[model samples]
Target: METAFTPFQSLAGGALIGVASVLLMGLMGRIMGATGVLAGLLMPANLADWSWRAAVVAGMVSGPIAVMLVTGEFPQVQVPVSSTMLVIGGLIVGVGVTFGAGCTSGHGVCGMARLSPRSIAATLTFMLATGVTVYVLRHVMGG
Candidate 1:
């Protein structure tokens, strides 16, 4: 089936993300990277840091719920893979985060925004890898 493209919704979501990132960095002195934030919870420097990390995670989880409550429907989601594949993919991503030192949100959004060379390189690598993977899957493997 054809899906609807909502440019206004996409723009609003991106604007909200930008505003939240700025406010987070300005007020809390933290980068609004979900993986890094979640990782911090696993290895917090001090006890006080845990509270804000928990709150951030809680907010992430609650966002979709809040949207559903306000709109009376959840956003459409389609997963073509099996549940086992999903779990395995998540585990692989977790391991990748450890090796890469950060995930896409950390390197692509927050890092690039800060004009860090490391992040710039990491984002480029991410895009290249993604492009190659898609090509392999769609063309080579007939996925």
Candidate 2:
């Protein structure tokens, strides 16, 4: 069988994520969503409203790098599809993030923690959309 993450490792990762989320919300009053972060960076107009976005983005980009340095074992990344498929999937995700008002990290973690109704709705939409997409790709499209 293929090697998989140990239970303790999974728990540690989850705990780290939870701690980081709490710290971000408590300190910066911001939701750690990569899509929104990147969008804000590209626009730069929104940077005036929030000064810490740069640091937040930097932390996100650096976290994995730091982990890699410590562990010395990079996770395997598999891309089973073509660049066109990847681009299409990315565009769809972007559209969903915009329409839902937040991505998975924002709604699934932070908003859910805060008991936000909009976040609940957005999270559900994201899940449903993901399920449908997977079903279509695997069964209907046979990809």
List the RMSD of every prediction in angstroms.
2.1, 3.0
lDDT of 2 by residue, 1-143 (tens): 13355798779777877888888778877777767767777676764544567777777678667778989976556677799989998998888788878789888888899999998988888789789977897789876
lDDT of 1: 0.86
TM-score of each: 0.87, 0.79
List candidate 2 segments past 4 Å from native. 1-9, 45-51
For residue 130, what is the lDDT in candidate 1? Answer: 91
Question: Model 1, 1-143: lDDT tens per residue?
Answer: 24468899889887877787888889899998888999889999888898888888888888789889989998777887899999999999898888888888888878899998988998898899899988898889988
Best-fitting candidate, measured by TM-score? 1
In candidate 1, position 97 carries an lDDT of: 81
